[model samples]
Target: MELGRLLLLQVFCAALDAGTTWLMWSRIDISVVLARIAGAFLAAILIVLFCRRAPEFRGIGRFLATSISLTCLLVSYGIFALLMLRNPVLQWPLAFAAASGASLLLSWIGYWRARQGRVSG
Candidate 1:
């Protein structure tokens, strides 16, 4: 993706993460909100880096790397959101699993769309 699009994606993802955090915590402090935004921003940078290098890998390797990066990007916010929610011990794993599953599903959809030439990046 071009630099502008990547930056836009990063900002959008960070805002989404921040919004989700605010919605979950309801009365969270500004510092925690900033932390969530920073975390998401970092994850987005890592994803962009990985995507830039993805062409170096061949076939399935490229696909897996891209997919994993995308998954992590989505899950980055969930990690903080889950921690703040602080559900019961058993529910913690369930929540994470659900988040991960959803992230994977979303990642796969994006990958499929890219493969079908439906998305530019």
Candidate 2:
């Protein structure tokens, strides 16, 4: 259940990121593709760092979490690239992908830390 929730959260975050990116691109006339890619990459790095620092998820789920984080970043960027256009509704998939990816990464890190503590103890 927690994992499911985390997945959902990741998807949500990704969506938000995509939306924000689109908004920025539309309003600022900036390079939407570059901005969106950069945002996802930055988010992924942050997720990994945060998970690593988290006391709970130190070692147990590190790999899984990192995978999720990486996936979400990739999905977010991919989806944005594929769906971001004049049409607003077509972008949901990318957003969801990004969010799910982030959640998984975070969860993995937390689990990893907890396992390490247990093993040491």
What does candidate 1's lDDT look like per residue over 1-121, in tens digits? 3323333444455455545545444565454535555546655675667567645432234555455556656665566466546743444334444554565455555545444452343
Deviation in angstroms for 35 in model 2? 2.1
Give the winner by lDDT: 2
TM-scores of the models, in the order given: 0.40, 0.52
Off by over 4 Å in 1: 1-39, 56-90, 118-121
- Cα displacement (angstroms), candidate 1, residue 10, comes to 16
Residue-level lDDT tens digits of model 2 in 8-121: 546555655667666767787786666676557656766677557644433345555556556656754655565555445655445445545544565556545555666897
TM-score of 2: 0.52
- Model 1 scores worst on lDDT over the 10 consecutive residues at 1-10
Best by TM-score: 2
